[model samples]
Target: MRADHPLRAIRQLANESLAALQADFSALYSGMGRPLIPPERLLRAMLLQAFYSIRSERQLMERLDFDLLFRWFVGLGVDDPVWDHSTFSKNRDRLIEGDEAARFLSALLPQPRVKRLLSSEHFSVDGTLIEAWASMKSFKPEDGTGPGDPPTPGGRNADADFRSEKRSNETHASTTDPDARLYRKGPGMEAKLAFLSHALMENHSALLIDACGTRVSGHAERVAALAMIEAHADRSRSITLGADRGYDAADFVNERRSMNVRPHIAHNLTRAKGRSAIDGRTTRHAGYAASQRIRKRIEESFGWIKTVAGLERPMVRGVDHVGWGFTFAATAYNLVRLPKLMARVT
Candidate 1:
C-alpha cells in the first residue's frame, strides 16, 4: 500500500479514538462466555463499509479476505481467517446496545487537532429521509382488516392494490418495521416508509458535530435541531443557527432566542399574507448573509452520506439501528475530510 494512502490517515485517527474508548468497549462484554470478534476490529470494518460503499456485510467479508489494504486497515493479518458475514448480523445488537457508534463519533471531536478545526459560534441543521428496509406492501392496516395473503402459489409478493383503500399512519403501520413512519418529502412527492435523520454541522468547517435518527413527524426536523444545538452549544457564549425556510416558525425562532442563539433563518414569505418569523433586525447583519451562503455547505455532507455512504436507503429497520448507522457514517465523513484539513493547518 502507498504511504500516502487516505486509509492510512483514517486508520491513525480511528486507532487513536478507539484506544481512548478501550475501557468502554471492554465494559460492553462479559468474561464468562467464549470471546467474540473484537469491537475495535468490527468498528474499523464498519468504517470501511461507509468509506468504500460496500453494499452488504457479505461483500465486505469477501473483500477483507483478499484485499491486502482492507485487511491491513482492519488490523487483520494475511494468515488470519475471515469471519462469516453472519458474525456482523449476530454482533450488531451488542454494539447498538452499547451505543458504540455514537461513542466512537463523540470520541473523534475532542482530539487536539480536530478541536481547533471546529467553530464555537456558527452552525446549520437539516434533515433527510432514510427509506426503511420494509416494503410498501408491508404497510398494513392497524386493525388487521387489510388484505391477506394471496391464495396463488408462490404468493410472497402477491399484488397489493390500494385503489379504494384509505391508509394513513394513524390507521396503518408497517408490519415489518413498526417504527418507520409513512412520510412525504414535500408536495407532489410519493410518501414512503422512512425515518428522519438530522445533522448539526458547524458552519466554519462544514464538519458534522452531531447527528440522530427519529421517527418521521411534521416537527421532527425543528425538534431535532433544537435538541442537538442545546447539547453542543456553549451556554456562556452566544451562537448563530442557520436553517432553511422550513425551520422558519415563531416557536422555533423564539426557542433559539431563549437560548441566546441568533436565528439566521430564511424568511418563509410564501406563507399567508407574507408572514415571516425572521425580520430585518436579524437579517440586517453582515454575518447573517455569510451564514446563508455557508449553510448550503451542509448539503455536501448530506450528499456524500446518502450517495457515497449508501445510506439513501438504509438496510436497518428500527430507529435505533438506523440512528447508529447514521452517526457512524457522520464520523466517517469527518475522518475523510479531516486529513486534508489538518494538512493545510500544518
Candidate 2:
C-alpha cells in the first residue's frame, strides 16, 4: 500500500492503534471459547461500511469477499472466508454494548498531530434528526388491542391509514422500533419516527469530539447538547459554545454560564416572549462573532454522515444501535478529515 493511497491512511491509523484497541477489546470478551473474529478486524470492516456507504452488513461482507482494497484494509487474507452476515451482526452487538465506537474516537484523538489541531476551548453543539427505519404503519396504539380486533390483511407490512388519526408520542409508539418517536423539525415539515443525533464539535477543525443519539422530543436536542458540553466542561478554563437560534432559550444560556462557560448562541428574536436569552453583553466580543461564523461548519458533519455514510434513514431499530452507528460514523468522518488536514499543514 502506497502512502498516498486513501485507505492507507486509515489502515495506518487503525494499525498504529491496534495494541490499545486490543486491550480494550479484551475487557469486552472473556477468552474461554472458540476463537472468534478479531474485534479490530470487525471495527475496520465497520469503518469500511461507513467509507463506502454500504447499506447493509450482508452487502458489506459481499464487498469484502471480492474487493482487495477492503480486504487489505480489514487485514483479511485473499483466501479468507467471509463471516456469515448474521454472525457479523451478532459480534457487532457486543461492540455496541461495550460502547467501542466512543472508545475508538477517544483513542484516535490523542495522536500528536491531531491533538494540535483540536480547539478545546471553542466549540459548537447541534443536533439533527435521524430517520428511523420503522414506517408510519408501525406506530400503533400503545393500549392493548381487543382479541376481536381484525388484523390488517397484509400483515406487518400492511398499509396503514393514519390520515384522520391524531397520532402523538403520548398516545402511540412504534411497534417496529419502540425507542423511535414521531417527530418533526418544525411545524410545516412532516414528522417521522426518528431519533435526535447530537454532536459537540471543535471549531478549529470542525471535528466531532462527542456524539450521542437520544429519543426524539422538543427538548431532547437542548438536553443532549448540555450533557455533551458538560462532559468536557472544565472550571479551570472558560470555553465558548456556539449554537443556532434553537438554543436561545434563557435556561440553556443560563446553564452555560453556570458552568463557567460563555454562551455565544445565536439569539432568537422571534420568540413569543419578545426577548432573547443571549444579550449584547456576550455577543459583543470578536470571539463570539467568529464562533457564530464557524459554528455552521458543524452541519458538514451531519450532511456527510447522513448522505455519505448512509445514515439518512438508519436500518437499525433501537436507540443504542442507532447511536452506535452514529458515533462510529463520526469517527469515520474524522478519519477522512485527518489525512487531508495533515497534507495541507505539511
Candidate 3:
C-alpha cells in the first residue's frame, strides 16, 4: 500500500491505541492455555470488518488468507495460516465478554494527538434503531401458547398470521434474542425487533466522544444522552448539549441544567400541546444556533457507521453483543476521519 493510503493512518492509530491497551488484553487471557489468537490481531481484524464492510467472520478470514493488505494490517506474515472462522468467532466472543471493545474505544481519545481535536464544552447526542438479528416470526408469546398452528407446519419458515391478533412487548418476546424489543422509529414506520444505539459527538471536530447501545424504549434516547453527557460533563464548567426535538422533555432539560449542561435541544412545538420544554431563554443565545448547525455533522458519523460500517442491521443478537459492535463501529468511524483531521492539523 502507498504511504498516503488511508489505512496507513488507521493502522498507525490502531497500533498506538492497542499498544496502550496491552495490559488489558493480557489480563483477558490465561497464560496457561494453548496460545489463542492474539487479542491485538483479533481487534485489528474486527476493525477491518468495519472498515471494509465484510459481512461475516468467515468472509473476513477468507480475505485475510489471500489479501496482502489485510495481512499486513493484521500483523500476519504472508505464509501464516488463517484461523478457522469458528475459532475467530469464539475468540471474539471472549473479547466481548471481557469488555475489550469498550476499553479499546475509551483508550483512543485520550491520546495527546487526538485529544486536541475534541470540544470539551460542546456536544451532540442522537440515537438510531439497530435492527436485531432475530426475525419477527420468533416473537412468540411468553406463555408458550399462541394462535393454533403455523400456515405451513413442521417447517422452520412456517408462516405466522399476526393479523387482528394483538401482540405487544408486554405479552410476547423474541425467542431468537430475548433482549430485543419491538420498536418503530415513527408513527407509520414498520416495527421491528431492535436495540437503540446512541452516539455523543463533540461539535468542534464532529468526533464521537462517547457511544452506547441500550434496550429500546420510549425514553431510551433521552436517558442514554443524559448518561453519556454526565459521564463527560465538567460540573465546574457548563457545557452545551445539542439534540433533536426528541430530547425536548421537561425532565430531561431540568436534569441537564442540574448537571450544569445547557440543553440546546431543538424545539418540539408539536409536543406537549405545542408547549416546548425549550423556551426563548435557551434559544436566544447565538451559541444555540451554532450548536444546532454543528449537531448535524454527527449524522455523518452515523451514516458511516450504518452504511459504510455495515451496522444498519447488526449481525449480533443480545444487547451486550450489539453494544460491543456499536461502540467498536464508533471507534472505527473516528479512525476513518482522524487521518484527514490530523493531516490538516499538521
Candidate 3 residue runs with Cα over 4 Å from true position: 148-156
Segments in model 2 whose C-alpha atoms lie over 4 Å from true places: 145-156
Residue pairs with clashing backbones, model 2: none
Residues 1-346 of candidate 2 have per-residue lDDT tens digits of: 6768878877787666565688889998898886677899999999899988899999999999999988988989999999999999999999999999998988888887778889889999999999999988778788945122346665554454566778889888888899999988898999889999999999998989999999987788899989989977898889999999999988888998999889999988887866998888898899999999999999999999999999989889899999989999999999988888877787
Q: List TM-score per model, in order.
A: 0.98, 0.95, 0.97
lDDT of 1 at 253: 97
Candidate achieving higher lDDT, 1 or 2: 1
**2 or 3, greater by lDDT:** 3
Q: Can you write out model 3's per-residue Cα lDDT over 27-63, one digit (the tens) per residue?
A: 9887886779999999999999999999999999999
Model 1: lDDT to the true structure:
0.91
Q: Which consecutive 10 residues in model 3 have the weakest lDDT in total?
A: 147-156
lDDT of 1 by residue, 151-256 (tens): 6675457777878888899999998999998999999999999999999999978999899999999899999999999985666888999999999999999999
